[model samples]
Target: MNDLALRGDNIVKRFGAVTALDGVSFTLGQGEILGILGDNGAGKSTLVKILTGFHQQTSGTLSVHGEETLLKSVDHARALGIECVYQDLALANSLSIYHNMFLNREIVRRGPARVFRLVDHKQMRERAAHLLEDIGVHVPSVDLPVERLSGGQRQAIAVARAVHSNAKILLLDEPLAAMGAREAALIIDLIMRLKEKGGLSIIMIMHNYAQTLDIADRIMLMQRGRVTYEQQSANTSVAELMDIVRREYRAMRATTAQ
Candidate 1:
């Protein structure tokens, strides 16, 4: 069996006269983390949206587990074992940690009361706590409201929810943005632990070069709706990535100066 978790080939997305992505292609191996880097409006978000089935590509092909597939909707993506943790973190602020963890997929007791669809709150709470602990997330209590938690703790809960869903491919958008150093380190440790566990493939959209270098097994850089650079993280340096961005910026400045 091929170990590819997800593969995108010659992906292109356009809106009227705007091309948000142009012939972007990449492959993610099982248990690997691929960090995507780009300046604002570089089509990073666009590609993520497409991959998560928020939008359909104008052209290109997507394969999951070596089989050609079309992700029809976000629900469809989830059904296919693909899950994304967007920057918004999408938690119900007033909901308890366990409630947020179960969200729409609440557990129902299997009995006469099952017809009423009574949510098994105890089961959910226990499972939520176990999931967090499994992911190395330390929380005060599963009964606590998510809004009460710090930003990093909330992010960890979101990631733990995804893991609980048994997602084969996880897409994370700006997981570390706006976090303090300690908070960022917490998420980084979680990601490293996830990688060590094996079988979960991750594609992380990152703006921090150092963070990306530290956590990503491979890196893909995009610019103006195209992939400008792709290389193994160990083989590339921050200076090399910065140099590429600098040259692109200089070229843009020269064009604007014309």
Candidate 2:
């Protein structure tokens, strides 16, 4: 079987006269993590939106497992085993952990009296507990509301929920943003564990160079709606990435001055 999980070729996106993404092309391998770094307006989010089916590209093709695909909608992306966990985490604070885990896709009892379509709360709770445990997420109780959990725990719940949903390619947008050192460490460890588990591909949008270097198998840097650098994490350094950014900034300043 081909080990390539996802590939984008010459992707372009335009909003009227504004070109948000300019011919971005990249490949994500199975069971590997690709970290994206960029300044504001670097087209990182735009590329991710297109990959996750939140937006359609004006031009370019996407391939999944070597098959060309046109991601029509977010649901269509999910149907293809693609899921995104954004910075917001998107959890219902008032709902129980299991309830939040099952969110839109709830389990229903199957029987003659199934017309009422009662949710299988028991099964959901058990499975939620199992999934959290499998992912090494610790909580006092699965029945507790998400509002009662800490930031790191809430983030873990979001990731675990995505994993439980059978996500093959996971897109995470600043998963560690606004987090303290301890909380960020928790999510970082979880991401590494997920990578070690195999069969799951991850694309992470990150701003922290140190953390990206630590977790990503490969690093991609974007500037002004285009990719400026791509390399294996093991072969690159934070200083090198900063130097690239500085050079780009200098060039932009020179052009504006002229």
Expressed as tens digits, the lDDT of each residue in 57-176 for candidate 1 is 999999989998888899998999899999899999999999999999999999897999999998999999888888889998999999999999999999988888989899999999
Tens digit of lDDT per residue, candidate 2, span 10-61? 9999989999999999999999899999998899989889988999999999
Runs in model 1 deviating more than 4 A are none
List the lowest-lDDT window of 10 residues for candidate 2.
109-118
Candidate 1 lands at a TM-score of: 0.98
Write down the TM-score of every candidate: 0.98, 0.97
